[model samples]
Structures are given as structure tokens and as C-alpha cells.
Target: MLRSVFLLTLCASVALCASEYRVKKASRASLNRLKRLINEKTEQQHSDEKKLIGVLDDSPLLVRDPTAQRHHDELAVNNLDEYFQGDVELSETQVEILEKEIVESAEDSKARRRRKVGKAPLYKRWDRTRPISYDFASSVPYSTRIKIRQAIQLWERKTCVRFQESGPNVDRLEFFDGGGCSSFVGRTGGTQGISISTPGCDVVGIISHEIGHALGIFHEQARPDQSSHITVNYRNIPIGRWNNFYPVSLSQADVFGLPYDAGSVMHYGAYGFATDPYTPTITTTDKNLQSTIGQRAGPSFLDFAAINIAYGCNQHCGYLPCRHNGYPNPNNCSECLCPDGFSGSICQYVQYTSCGAHIAVSQDSVSIYSPNHPYQFDSNSECVWLLEAPPGGKVFLEFEDVFQFGCEDTCDKSFVEVKTGPDFRVTGYRFCCSTRPTKRFQTLGNEMLVLFKGNRERSRGFKARVWSDVSPIFTTTSSTTTAATTTTTVSTTALTTVAVEESTTERLSVAVSHGVSGKEVAVKSVADAGNGSARESVSKRIANEKKNAHATSWFVLQERTF
Candidate 1:
């Protein structure tokens, strides 16, 4: 009698939970109607657009339209499916709650326009302190599973969010081979389902994008500040596709103080839902970024930064100092997660490249040019130049002579990026066309980073001159010489050992010597140390010595050479 009573109570609880998260499946008639509508829309799309989409279908880096694939998967998920905003699957209760919020926001539309940023509610965000559980269905393809793992690694590398295979956790994500790519936003009670179809939705960027939704991130274009950056063309949009361009209200999403990013992997392509393929449905305010909007080349630096902020990843190393808009790395608190063109332990150095340099700016203009300027540059190459001026001064740049690269509407193939703004984290102004820029550029701060990327269809690159507004009080060469001449004496009775390591193009040399009392042994090393293993070994040895030698005083100097 007791066993029967317990079973009845358990069954009642399960039935109540099911009603709260119930999804209404589509009927066969609804699926057939949606198929006919898709056929009609496909016939309207231009031939050139179809060809362009086909060429970029398999490319991971290039920007491409995935609307056709999305539509195809939509059928697989079944027509008349109760999908919210095209791809998100929400419970019946969730839909009502979101709808109520939308109606409330619409009532105060005028007030909402004054606000900026978009963020999910705090209650909906996952608890970052705990590991998020996930599992893959047995039916998921091996290749698709690999892509999903790669996507998960990228998120873990960039943020404090942790994920593990499903264990005893009741609230978890279960990945299965559905007809479309879709997921519920944030964490819901019990096991939530995420669909990742094979052949169509297996790209790393696409997988990352879907995982982003599960992490509570909405589409980038849905931000409240989107209107300031992009213009949506409703006339070019097909019927029933206007919902894809709807912007989320400020009350629904938070921007976390990040500016609008056109290159976010979550952004839709220019012709995403366009009936007239020649016209873009979404156009960037900065016309140069037209091709950048729909990029699926992994997450942008801002995307990772935003996630880190959302998950409170920076709190892990609040005591550490990072420069140039960088934050402390969650995985390694000793180091910083830098922007695209910056590196070093604290993001104080420009990312080193074989063809670039660290240039000191003076009142006299210094000429800077791409590698093999006036000649076709090598394919698949990247270079970065750091231009610095004295304190309280700004660097000025002017383009001169020839300027050419692989030209695209959005400068996707090859481009020269100049970062002149005060914030180094955002995407910089890019130039790839053959024509030289008519106007000069000036940095808001004392430093500026210029990057050049070359693709297979290379051409003669650009030439530019840079100078400082204020003359330096002292030359860098003089300052270095003065510091080098200074000396310190150490009074040690015991013999002191010193080791020096240096590498040239031909060989690596290590020298160890002993010094007598009252004499100090100063060791210096220099090299174009492109190889990482040598540095790693040196670091490991220094760390081991520091850990083992408790009584002895040890001084270690490490330098990065480019």
C-alpha cells in the first residue's frame, strides 16, 4: 500500500513538469504548406546569389549566406513547428513570459529607444561557478561530434564557463541529430534539447553560434544599439521573414558595455532573407564592413570578451593588471587574454610577425610600407606594426604612393587595418581597394597598431608615413644607452653562478660562469626567438629553480625578441 502511494505521487509530479515545458508539434498539412512557400521564395532568388552561396557553402572563414540551409533544416524540424524567432525552441510557458515582456516593452517604446545594450535576465543566466553538463546522442555523426568538441574548446579557452559530459545533473543539454540547428536560450529546468544536423550545420563557427544561444547570447544584430550601426531593408525581405530582423528590446537583453560589432559570428549575412538577391537586406553604416557582417570564421574578439564579462571571468584575476583593453585570462590568471593584434603577458606588446616592426615616432615622418612593397606580396601572410609616440603626443598617418590588395566589397580577401581609436579592442578601419585614401588618420592615444593581411590573389601593397605631433624630449636610442651604462654591485662571499642563453640564425649558445665576492654577475640574452619550445624550456627551468631553491636569492630576467 505504501509503495503504490509513492508511485502515484511520483507520476503526478512528472505529469505537472511535462505540461509546463510542453512543445506543440506541427501537423503534416502544415509541413507541406511551408515547403510550397519555400519553393516560391527560392524561385525569386537571383542566379548570381545562388552561385555565390554555393561557392562559400563549405568555407569556414569566408562570409556566406546560410539562409538556404536554415530553410532546409526548418523543413526537417517540420513546418508549423512552434519555433520562436525562426531558430530558438522555447517552452510554452517561456513563450508566454517572453511575449508579455515584449508587449510591456512595446508600450514604452519611446523610453526604450533612449537605452542601449541587450542582455538576458540574471535569473536565466547559467551559474558559472558550477560545471554545465552536456551530452551527444548516439545517432550524432562522428565528424559532427568532432566539430562540436572544437566549438566547446573555443568557449572554454576564452571564458570561465565550464562544461562536462552529462552525469547526475538534472538540468543539462542533450545534443541530437535534428533536421535544423536550434537550441533553447539559457538554462531551463530538466534536460533541454539542442539540434545539430549533419552535412548542413557541422561547421565550427555555426556550432559555436548555436552553443552561444545555449549560453544565453542572442543575435548580435538584435542589440538595442543596432540601428546606429546597420540599416535594415524591409522592402527586400520576403514574406514571413521580417521576424528574423526584429530587434530585441533593451529590457530583454543587456549589452554589458560592449559596442556594436559587425563581424560577430552571430550576425546574419547581408542578403540573409532577401527576395531580390541583388539588394542586401541588411547594410552596414560603414560600407567597408558589408562583407564582414556574416562572417562565420569563429567568434570575434569582442564576442569572447562579452562572454567573459557575462560569466564574471575577470573576477578570477582582479588583482592582475592588463593593458590596452585586455582582461586577465580565466584559464591562466598570470597572463592576459589580449585583443587580436596585441600579445605579451600583460598585452603591452604588439603581436610579433616576421615582416613587421616596433617603430618609434618622431617629429620627422617615418615611412612604413607592407612587405615587398611595389611588388606582389606573398600569399597567406599577416604582418603587424606598432607605432608609438612620446607621452601626451598623438601619432599621425598619411597614405602615399600605391595602395592595392585583393579587392572585395567588404575587404574580406586582403586588407590593411589601421587602429586609430582610443579603444584598441574594436575592429579598425580597413583599406583594400587599389585607390589610396584621400584623408590622413590620427591616433587618439600615443600608440597605433597597423595590420596587413594577404590572401592568394595578392597585389602591390600600400605605403604610408607616420609622425608624432609633439617632439620627444629624449631619443629612444639615448634612453637605452643611458640605462645600459648604469651598474649595481652585490657583496656576496659565496661564489655566485650566472647563466646566459642566446640564439642566432645559425646556433644557440648557453654559457655558465662563477663570480667572486663583491662582484656581481650580470647576464643578458638576445635573439629573434620565433621558436616557442626554447622559451618554454627556459621558463620551466627558471620556475623549477624558484620552487626548489628556498634559501638562495635568485634574480631572473626574461625578454621577448621579435
Candidate 2:
């Protein structure tokens, strides 16, 4: 009987083992099927996103309407759902405050038609004493998270503001994949959501721009003084979209005394909200700056300065002596936050790039040219030349020879920028076309900064002459001038009037020959009264003479010596 019981127990144990093996096999198969379904769904989502991006690319607007399903539907109505001024998301309280301000402003304007003064817009600033808390939603793509982190790093590096991840139930910024790129301006006391659309809003500059709005900074063109810099062409815009071009009152937006920056990333592009793609909705007062208005290259130097001022970052090192309009750096009090094309501990030197130099100006003019002048310059080259004059003196700059580079409306790709204003913090005059500048540039102070940026397109560079003038003479002169009986000496970069002999003849003949090919570029005869002042005649004769009429050939100029 004991032997029979042992055999029965063995049979039962084998049956239990077989049952367990079959159950394990079925579970493995089920897990494999679940993984396959997940992968297929992910692939489909990616494909749909690609198709959406293709549609978005065809639209002229950079920022899309988060509420609309189709791009064209964005223009269907004047007001977007839950959005202010197109892409700014505002809380109910903030919206109420804005509407009240607008109504009051309209009433005030009606009361004072002769002198319109609108109240400042309401802006809630984030607390600067503590680190800004931020977090990502599960839906945010990993790649987008990386871009947001990079933008945060840049802002932290440039300013004194700090940012960190948030804890549970804390007031923080939540980044999620909204239908389009949008964010609330400044802190809203609770969890503020920043929508960073995938694929469409992946650019670093675009990301930084949205973050800028969240930092209590409005659109550059929204400032009260925007009318002085940019003109809004309402005819090119639809009636419903006119609200996008409305200016924020001075009281509403505090600029911290910074100048209006056309290159600010917050500014709209030329064709923004335009009814016609070829026609621009906005035109800059400074025609050269038309292309610079809507740039997504990141924040301008003044943009950073304004943020520092707004957040009280400038107070940290108020006593620090920073030069060239540079402010003391909040990150390191010992250093300074220098402007573009400027560097050094106190910003007393020119920024060093692949090719550049610190040039000293004297009474005698000196020639400066792009690296490899008279030939095609290298791509991706940045050169900065700091022209410093004696104390109480002024620096004069003139473009002499052929000026050629990659031409764009914005000069985004390649250009030559000259910062001649007293405030070095603002963007300088940029020239990118083949046409040489006709007007000479002079600085208000003793210093001038020249920056040359070259991109993928390599073309013949430029030649310029710089000098120091002690007298305060700020005048614009034509490149072509007429004078009598002058001995013209021309070179590749300079033209010196060796001697101007007094001649009795009323007709003065002048000839300018190219230094390279030895070909006569310009020959002219002028009828001037011999009684005219020698100083006037001598100064007028010295001008840039172009060779071969084509921009490819080198240019020579005649210099005036009194």
C-alpha cells in the first residue's frame, strides 16, 4: 500500500509541472504582442507629426494658433480662444486687467486727442529672490526637453536668474506638447503651462523667444516707442489680425531704459500677418533694418540687458566699472556682461574671433579690409575690429572699395556691422549688399566697433578707411565729388591727394587708376570757380571710385589732405 501511494504522488507532481509550463509560455506570447502594438502606435504618431509639420511649413506665420485645427482657420476670427495677442496665454485675472486697461486707454485717448497718452500695460514679474521652478509633462518629447534645457542654460548663464525642477504641488512652469507654441507672460501664482509644439517649435531661438515672453518681456514691436522704429502696414494685414500689431503702452511695459531693438527675437518678421506674401506688413524706419526686425537668432544684447535690469541683476555689481555700455555680470561680479563684438573683464577690448584686431586711430586715416580682401572671404568667419581714438576725439569710417557679401533683407547670413552710436548696447548699422555705402559713418564717442560675419556664401569682401578727427564735424558727404587741379595718388585701399596746386583754369581734370590692374577706373572734368576755398575743393575731391562698374573688381578712393 505504501508503494502505491508513492507512485500516485509522483504522477500528481508531474501534472502540476506541465500545467505551470503552459501558463508561462502563454504569458511570454502576450507580452511580445503588447510590445509590437506599442511600437506600431509610436510609429504612426511620428508619421502624423511629419505630415503636420509639412503643412505648417507652407504657412508664413511662425507661431501657430493653439486652438485651431487647420492653419487657415487661424485667420478666421479676430480673437483666438484662451490666447492673448496670438500666442500669449493669460489667466482670467490677467485677461480682465488687460481688457480694463485697454478700455481706459481708449477713453483717455478720446479725452486727449491732441496728445494721446495710454496707460502702461500690466505685467506681473517673477520673483527674483528664488529659483524659478519648472517641470516637463509626460507628453513632452525627449528632444524638445533637451532644447528647453539648453535655452534655460543660456538665460541662466547670461543673467542672474536661476531655474530648477519643481517639487509636488509647487507653483512651477509645466512644459507640454500643446498644439502650437505658446506661454503665459510672467508668473501666474500656480502651475503655468508652456506649450512647445513638436517638430515645428524645435529651433533653439524659437524656444528662447517663448521663454522670453514668460520672463515678463513683451514683443519688441509692442513697446510704446515701436512706431518710431517700425511702421505697421495695416493695408497688408486683414482687419481681424490688426490686434496683433497693437502697441503696448509705456506704462504697461517697462523697458528699463533700453533702446528698441529691431533684432530682438521677440519682434515679428516682415511678412507677419501679411495678406500678401511678397508685401511686408511691417517696414523699419531704418530701411537697412527691414530684414532684422523678425529674427529668431536668439536674444539681442539689449534684450539680455533689459532682463537683467528687470530682475534687479544689475544691482549686484552696481559699483563695478564696466566700459563700452557693458553692465556688471550678475553671475560673476568680477566680470561684465559685454555686448556683441566686445569682450574682456570690463569690456575694454574687442571680441576675438578667427580674425580680428584692436586698431588705434590717428589723424592720418588707416585702411582696414576683410581677411583676404579683393578675393572671396572664407565661410563661417567672424571678424571684429575695435577702432579706438584719443580721448575727446571722434572716429570716422568710410567704405572705399567694392563691398560684396551674401545679400539678404535681414543680413542674417553675412554682413558688415558698424556700431557708431554712443550706446554700444544697441545693434549697429549692417550692410550686406554688393553696393558700397555712400555715406561715411562717424561715432559720437571716440570708439567704434566694426564686425564682419560670413556664412556659407563666400564672396569678395570690403575695404574701409578709418581715422580720428578731434573736431566735432558730423556731416554726410557724397562719394563722388569735384575739385580743381589735384594730384591724385591711388592705391588698392587708399587715395591720397599729394598736392593741390593753384590753377587759373576753371575746369579741373582728375583721373583715378586702379592699383591692381592699372586700368583707369574713373576720369572726370569739373567746372569750379578758382575763387572757391582750397579746403572745400580739396575735401570734395577725395571720394571712392569704382573700377569696371562691376562689384567684382577692386575699388580705389582719393583722400583729402588739408
Candidate 3:
């Protein structure tokens, strides 16, 4: 008895949940009115499922006159029975709702008569949960299934809504072989049918187009503002087919402020509904673009933007710092897919720039400031500074009071470059957008190039001082008997560039007994550099050189060739 009572309670719970999602029934009067207008005589007499099928198979006259019956071929794919309102398939509930809206529009039509009469959109949408569910029929081949999955992925990548496989008990899309390729606009409550007729509907683009309709988007040409951009030649259309070109009201069509896009994936081709195959039916404002319209390649950028706007995908990002560099991904709003050379959680990092001023610095010391020094720097600029030290010296650079640019590791946006040589051929130390300034950069070579560049644009570039400082001279005189007591002096120097005060250190002199190549040469310290301020400068500079001693090599040695 207890078990029986539990089963009964569970059944009740399921029924309650089902009722929440059930499609609301239209009033008998409203349904009857729509049936008369559309000429679906058996609509009220049939079952719900039968009624839907009947609507799909019927096509009523939309105009007073139509082409001759001899010319109207029933086998044509573009026949009026293909869809209602050109390609949209409306449910009974939708038709009733549309009737009510039509009544309201007629009452307001007089007031709005003086306003613009451009076509508007139909506003009815799906009653779907956040992510829509879909499943395939057992007869769907693996190859076809792959294509359909790809279509779903394409939409998922662009829009906030997601599509996932559904279980047996849930409302979902069921793909099956039908008379033709088609899908109902938005959701139709329970398990909906999306025809994937083989041979004709096997293309990737076609699959995406059908899925777009199921996602609640209408055709691009059916947009309310289409009249402003293209000419729909009704003369080329058949009499009863005029409903195919019916304009939707602005209230029904939620365009989300996007412009008319003729190249949308949801658009039909130029010959969409041509009464005669040779005559064009849809013409664009610019005749040259006629061929470019009605592309079924994939969703355009605007299409993605509109879907994102509809689902508030970007808004889901909350306080994330994605600005000019990136748009938040709909799937994962916290993460972002940044443009090339940009990275980080919010796409704040810039890699490098190719524009600026070129500066060659060969002086003992020079101060380099951004273009328009104190003011903001120019956009798309490349500036280079070449610093040459004394014959045996290195270049010392330090940041001044101001330094700023778009921050990144490679400094792609705005940055300061300090290189080993006076050109960009080699790698260098690059500094970009950051609150902490760079203290110093001392090059091993006598010549160094400092490049400054800005990618797009930003404020107060950067100010830096470059000074050429000589390492404490270490003179080594080696006498060789073969060359009449020839003397060679070897000097080892260190890099001493600082952001603070200017000072130097003492030099170290060493005595060396030279030997033949590949043999070890003995060396001994001979004397300390001179004392006092002069010696202190040399000593300080020498100390700086020691700090980088581990990094020293033959590259730091200065010598003369005989």
C-alpha cells in the first residue's frame, strides 16, 4: 500500500512539471478566425498533430490573381506549399497569437499611417530553456551526424545559447528524413521535427540555415528595413505567392539595432522565388552586389552579434576587463578569445608595433622622448633610436620621470626597445605598458638601438635617457718575439647604466704572460684604479660591470687588428 501511494505521488509530480511547459491553447474563436483567413477548412476538425501536418500541406491565395495552372508545376521545389510566408512554418498557437497582433496593428494602423511603412519583423519566439536540446534518429548516418554536429558547433561558437544531446524524457529536436529540408521557427514545445532530407539537405551551409531558423532568427531579406536596401520585384512573382514577400511589423521583428545584411547565411539566393527562372526576383540597391547577396556560406559577423545581443552573452561577463581588444565568449563569459598578439584574461596584452619615428643615437648621451613629448603619442608610428658608445664602451639607459604605453611582453602596442646593436635585425629588451618602470639597460656592444613604437594610439608615450659609459680600462700588453716585440692591449669593460645618479668606478689592471693560441695564458692583478672622485667613477662603473660578469664573453672585448 505504501509503495502504491508513492507511485501515485510521483506521477502527479511529473504531470505538474509537464503542465508548466505545455503550449497554451488559443481561443476557439481566434483559431476559427485564422482558419478562415488562411483557408484551412479541416484545421478545427483534426487532431493537434493532424492539424499541424495539414497546415504544412496547404497553401492559400495571397493575391487576387495568379499565373495559369498549366505553368504552375507541382514538382517545383519553390512551390507555395514549401512554407508559409515564403519559408517560415508557424504553429497553430503562433497563428492565433499573430491574429491578435494583427487586430491590434489595424487599430493603430491609422495613427502609424503617416510614419515609415518599411517592413518590420515578426516577434514570436521559442519557449526554450537556456540551452536547447537535440537528438538524432537512429537512421542518421555517421557522416551526416558529423555535419549536423558541426552546424551546431558553429552556432554555439557565435551565440550565447548552447545545444546538447537530449535524454529520452525531455523536449528536444528530432532529426528525421522528411519531404524536404525545413525546421519550425524557434521551439514548438515537445519533441520537434527538423527535416534533414538526404541528397538535398546534406550540405553544411544548408544545415546551418535550417538550424538558424530553429534558433529564432528570420531570413535576412525578410528584415523590416530590407525595402530600403533592396527591391523585391513582385511583378516577377506568381499571384498567390505574394505572401512570401509579406513584411513583418517592427514589433514582431526584434532586429536588435543591427543593419541590414544581404550576405547573411539566412538569406535566399537572387533567384529565390523567381516566377520565371531567367528573370531576377530580388535586386539590391547597388546592382553590382546582386551576385554577392543570398550567400549560404555561414553566419555573418552581424548574425553572431545579433544572437549574442539577444542572449545577453556579453553582459554575462560581469566586471571582466575585456575592452577594445576582445569580446567575451558566449560559452564562457569569463574567458575571452583575443585578437592576434593580444592575451591575458581580458586581452590587455599587446605583442608589438610596426609604426613610429626612427632615431639613430651615436652621441655620448641623449635623451629620447615620445613624439609630442608631454602629450599623447601618435597612432600607428615607429620610432627608432640608435646609441653608439665609445670604441670600447657600452650604452647605459634609464627611464626618466614619465613612461607609459600599452602593456605586453613583446610590447606590440606601445613599447621601448633596447637592442644590442643599432638595428632590429637582432633580439633586444622590450618594455611595455606597466606601472613599474624599467631601471636600466646596458648593452654589451658599442652600438645599441632603442626603438619606440605605438600600434593604435594612447597617452604620454615615454621618456628615457641614454648615456654611453666607459668601463674601467684594463690594459694588457703582450710582447711576442716573432714580431719585433709587438704589443697588444686587452681591455675588459662592464655595463653601468642606472636610472638614478651618474657615477663611475675604478678600473682593474692585470699583467699577463701571453702564449700561443689554444694554450693557457697566466694573468695577475698589477694595480688598482686611481683614487678620489675620478677613480670612484671608474670604480663604480667597474662594479656595475662585475654584476654582469657572468654574462660577459668575447662579445665584450675591445681590440685592434694588426
Candidate 4:
């Protein structure tokens, strides 16, 4: 499973130490010296929009856990003179920037080959013009080779980067079976060896993750801005491994203006470094999204975007607009990254029937229906309706009849969502998928997006209408009981029939809106509200006694004086 080993680190420390937190002046100086060295070769100044602001300064030495033992499969490389993260081996010049005291030594340490100085920048990306080459060691099984091919295909399908078989004499990646799965970030030059240990490091997602590191992107949570989205439960982390929670500085990263994606394959899981089952090492601000932190289901859309951006693949459009909800793809400038709901060259066409018709509201009121409504909607159909109210006014949406899609936690299978404002950053509501009833919804701004999506599961579509609301709406509710039966009369522009049994004390709410005729009857099936609880009860009663089915129920009606 993707969650099983997602973001699991390779190394384990020997013992826990005392709590010693300090920002050493020498460490900062070391970092500054490395930057100065890189700047002399090629000084690349990122635009403000693409820059990452460092939120936390390097500080406090973390206490390693004393009880934890190292995994037998993991190769201990802590003794190396310089390593950027724990896994990536640094160049001779790069290694010199690390403070000597902090660099631990392993028992089997040897003098590494010293390469000539004057390389490109420390974080120099791979050349997109040239293909990355790789060859498998003889020990690698056929299954592992196939998995590696699949991972490469995934990247090729999404990005412009290509992976080719390494020739005998060329400098390329040499995959070998070793202690544990690990790879250097980006191109380290020459023949770089990526280890994929036998038994444990066999999963395709794990291989893809290591490949991602080799492609130049770091862990998603390693970004400095991640703290705002996810909280590090340092207490639950293994002792001496607190440094794993530390993020890289802003100068060391480029966000490219993308939002922090929890579902990215590069993100660590909630229990990634957890010391115990009950404690989680990572927690999200939105608790519901914690499970998504270490999702290794494959690289997310943003991950693909980041790769294209880093490799300079999205240069074709030259800032041309992609209409509708289309995002420009860095790999192909002429193409766009359109969601499932839309299509076309610029994503102007609505492909999925479930994405219903695109209707723009410019008048006082307008109504919309699902594709082939009165009947069930098509499978995999997604409909989007854009509603724009009068200038300086808000939109009021009322669903005269809404069927299909029972309430669930996330309306994942099928549901409608409302987004408010110009950018639609504020989610108005995700309805028909939870306990919350879809009542009349009013937007806070002039624009609102009503999106309806349906899966293969069939259900009668919804019919809704929206109107401009110059001011906010207010409502009054009162109840009165008659002698014969506990009759409740609800009044509005139209008459709505709602039958409630006096014997059973069930809370029933009935909402009615004014229609074209001013005396029209609005019919809302009992199944649409309370997720069919009321409808089930009515069906049971009808099945038990067929005679009472003919007896009509009375509705309390209030005549509008207007």
C-alpha cells in the first residue's frame, strides 16, 4: 500500500541524548559560504512570485533516541564529510560548508574520490534537452526492472523529461541492489548509483519516490511554508531524528507559486516517523486531510506541474491565457492541464455530461437542470454552472428539486459544490453528500460556481434556480396545533405539501419559494431530505397497509396577502 512505507526514512540513530537547542553562529556562516561559492559560478535571481520566504531559521540540535537501533538493511553514511540531507552525498567543496562537529563518522568510512572544483550551482537541475540514462545491475530481478520502467513511463507521460537506457561508456544512473533505497537529489554528475534494497524496497511507489528525488524535487513537507499547513509532532518522533522534521531554507528552494499539496507523492505520511502506534509524527491543520499527507498513490497534478516548471518545459504558451479552468502545462505550451470536467484547446468545452450545461445568470432569475433531467444523469458526467449576480449584488440559490447522491462525508462519488467570489477560494458548501441539508444558499459576492458531478451510480438529477439578491434574507418560523391533528402551516410565495404524523415527534422542516405562477406547487421528494430516512419510513408504511395509500394527506396552507 502507498501508505505503508510512504516517506519512511532510511537511517535510525543509536541513542537518545539531552535536550540541547541552539542556533550556532558558525552553522549560518557555513551556509552563507556555500551560497557565495555557488553564486560566483552562476547567480540566478528568482522572481518574487517564484521565491520561497524562509519562515524558520536553522536552530537547536535535536536529541536522538538512544533506545532505537539501526535497521540492518540501511547503509550508515553519517560519517561522510558532507551530505545535504541524510541521503544525498555532497561534493568536496559542498561538504566543506558543514560544521565539522556536527558531521558524524561511520566505522567503515574511507576517503571519497575528490573531484575537481568549479561545478555548476549546488542545486543545478538536469538538462531538459538531454535524456537521463540508466542501467540495471545483474542482481535486479525482472519484476523490479518492470516496475522501474513503469515509473519512468509515468513521468514521461506527464512531463517532457525522457529516460533512456545507459550506454556502456556514457555517464548515467547505475541501479544496484544494496542496503536500503536511496538516491541523490538531482544530477550529481557522472555515473550516480541509486540503491534499491532487495526485500523491503520492492514497491513501485517506493521506486517512484526515489526517482522523484533524483529528478530534483525534495520532500513536499521539507518546504519552509509547510509549517503553516502541517504541524510537526516532534514529541512523537523518534529521539535524535528531530532533524528530519527540519525544513530547508528559502534560499535552498523555489516554490513556483504552487499551493502546498498534501496528497503529493513527495509528502510524508502522518505516521512516517512515529515512535509508537498511538502517536503520529505528522499532523495536519485539517484533521480529515492527515491521511492524505503521505499518499503515494503516485505523483499528484501539482507534482507534475512542479517537475515541468523545474525543467523549464512549460515555456511554449509565453503567458497566453487558457480559458475556463485550464492550467498551463510546462511540458507542452500549446496544451493545458484541464480537470475532468472540462476540455478543448483552452478548456472551453464541457466534456463530461455530468458537468451539465454552463449557464451564465445575467437577469433577475434563471433556472438550470441536470443533463437529461426528469431522468437519471449520464455516468461520469460533471456539470458546471457559473452564476453572476447584478453588479454589487449577491446571488441567492434555491433548489426547487434535488435528487440523486445520498449524503456522505466527502461527496466523492457524486455531488454538487458551490464556490464563492472571483477566485472561488471560499468554498460555499459541498452538498448532497453529508448530514447538512441543502437549503437556500446565498453567495457573499457577485459570482458563484455551482458544480454538479455524478459517477456511474444512477440517480435523478437536480433542478435549481438562482436570483440576484440585493440584500440578505431573513426568515420567521412559528408552529400551531389544531384540535383534530397537529397541523403546521408554512407560508411563502408557493404552496408546498409536507405531511407529519402527530403520534411520532419527528422534526420536519419545509421550505417554499415563490414561483412564476405565484400559486405553483413545489414538490420535493422525502428521499431528497435527511438522505432518504423519511422516504424509507413512508415506503414501509405503504407496504404494510395498501388501503391507507389512497387516503390523501392534508397540507396547512397560508394565503399570501401580496
What local distance difference test score does each model get? 0.60, 0.60, 0.49, 0.49
The 10-residue segment with the lowest total lDDT in model 1? 474-483
Query: How do the residues 380-498 of candidate 1 rate in per-residue lDDT, one tens digit apiece?
Result: 87777777776798999898988987654344457788888578777776666676665678888898888888964768888887888875452111101122221111111233222
Candidate ranking (TM-score, best to worst) = 1, 2, 4, 3
* 227-268 per-residue lDDT for model 2 (tens digits): 577766665656545566666665566665678788787777
Candidate 1's C-alpha runs over 4 A off are 1-86, 106-123, 362-370, 373-376, 396-414, 430-440, 455-562
Please, what is the TM-score per model?
0.67, 0.65, 0.46, 0.51
For candidate 3, report its TM-score.
0.46
State the local distance difference test value for candidate 1. 0.60
lDDT of 3 by residue, 1-562 (tens): 5543344334332534323333333444554455354333222222365322211102121111122111111112323455565445565667766667655554334222121111123333443245676766655667878888888888887676677765333445666555466776666656566766565666676778778777767777766565576666655655445445544556655676566655466765555566765445566664423434554546655666667766566775665666323567766777665432334456533322322211122333446666665677777666544444557777777777666666321233466655553322222444555442445677766655566667645767777766666533334333232212212232222222211111122112111111111222221111122224643543443344333222111123212222
Which of the two, 1 or 4, has more lDDT? 1
Model 4 C-alpha lDDT versus the unseen true structure: 0.49
